[model samples]
Target: MTMSLVFRNEKFSPDRFTGCIAERYQFINCDFSGCDLTDTQFIHCQFYDRESEQGCNFTRATLKDASFKHCDLSMNNFRSVNALGIEISECRAQGIDFRGASFMNMITTKSWFCSAFITKTNLSYANLSKVVLEKCELWDNRWVGTNVVGAIFSGSDLSGGEFSSFDWHSADFTHCDLTRSITSDLDLRSTDLEGVKLDSDQVSILVERLGIRVEE
Candidate 1:
């Protein structure tokens, strides 16, 4: 039993929508500024151009199977969400906290996630292209089979992450921390590794990949 609701051009500021449950809702051009949506559940919802005028607070919200297209979600708190099968495209998600969130089967394209905290998040089988994750915390995250073409990860922490099936040929890893991160199967010939922080073992692996024999 799923109820359909629509909130078009509505504003929710300084309010509390905690513990609310809604299914198949549509939010078009709605503003959610300074609102506390903690523990609120929205299943199969679609948000189009949803604005966060003063930074909508979605801390601990459950947005399972939701889709956001061309929405402004900057400076929002999206930590601890059950975001499985989510689709976000052409959205502004800068400075959001997505740490420890579950994002399986997600697809995000042409979105901005700069300075966001996404450490320890599971993004397996996700496709993210032309996205900006610069200066974001991405340590200990699982990115197996993730498509990250044309993505920017400059000055981000990618330590202890598994990137076995990642397509990072056009992605930027400049000044990033790859300490203990797995790149055994990656072709670093065209990938940007300028000023990247790596341990001796990681450096050795990269040198070996380039067919450079080192004498010690």
Candidate 2:
């Protein structure tokens, strides 16, 4: 049994709502600052507001199967969040911390995630379209079979990640770091790698793919 609670235009500041389950709730113009929402479950919820610029903090929360459409969730602390199968469309989630979070099969469209921390996070099979992740920390993150069409990843650290199943031709990776990143199986003939930072061994691997002969 899940206890549902709906909040509309309400201010929930400095409140602790731990381990609560709310479903199908509509949050409009709600302010949740300095709030501890650890282990809370919010399913099928809609959080949208154009007039307000305030975002909520969900540090260590469990927001599995939630939907956020046109909401401002920027600068939120989402470290170790359980956001698997979450749907976020046209939302602002810039500078958010998603370290060690599991977002498998999540869907995101037209969202802004600039400078966000996504270290050691699992985004396997996630679908991302027209999303901006510029200058974000994406170290050791799993992106196997993830669709990232029209996504911007300029100036982001992509070191130590498995990117073999990604479509590089449709995504932008200007000036991104590929140090110790796996790309031997990726087809980079049509993909642009200008100004990208790569390790010496990784460069050799890419050069060999271009039919270049190297003598040691």
Candidate 3:
């Protein structure tokens, strides 16, 4: 806490910030709904809106196990958010839309399971097109130009990620670890590394971008 709660243009109603613990807050144009915000934390918060591009809404929010440290949450909307087990560390969360965020937990109706931790976040240009986040932890994120056409992130760890103009053929990352990630373009001949885990200098920089010369 330690002062700094602003919450301008507020519209909260529904468990109003349940289990709260905020710090350094601002949250302009706030309109959070259905807020349960279980185990909420939220340190160094801002929730963006630098004169309009819109931010801070959290529509249909539950935020099951919220954390959100060092937050800015740029351009935030978070439609239909349930955010099961959410964490979000060192956040900037640029361009965050997270369409209909759920972080699954069905257990029936075709049994489902997903959870989020989202470490060291920047999440540049975030949209997360078809989010699933299979076995989630999501370490050291930056993900510049991130849209993730049909995101799955199967057995995810995403170790030390940056991923410069990331496309990786619109995302599924089976059994992913992506050790010390900084994949400049990740074109492993059309990308689809079965049980992905690269390291060894990122497989010699993705086999020298397919020119191949690993004579070591």
Alpha-carbon shift of residue 209 in model 2 (angstroms)? 1.3
What is candidate 2's lDDT per residue for 47-67, written digit by digit as tens? 444456443445545555544
Q: How would you encode candidate 1's per-residue C-alpha lDDT over 98-136 as one tens digit per residue?
A: 554444332476443343445554556554555566766
* lDDT per model vs. reference: 0.60, 0.60, 0.86
Best by lDDT: 3
Cα misplacement distance, residue 133 of candidate 3 (Å)? 1.1
Minimal lDDT window, size 10, model 1: 48-57
What residue pairs are clashing in model 3? none
Q: Which stretches of candidate 1 lie over 4 Å from their true place?
A: 1-113
Q: With candidate 2 superimposed using the best TM-score fit, by how many Å does residue 211's alpha carbon deviate from the native?
A: 1.6
Which residue runs of candidate 2 sit more than 4 Å off their true CA positions? 1-113
Q: All candidates: CA RMSD in angstroms?
A: 12.0, 12.4, 12.4
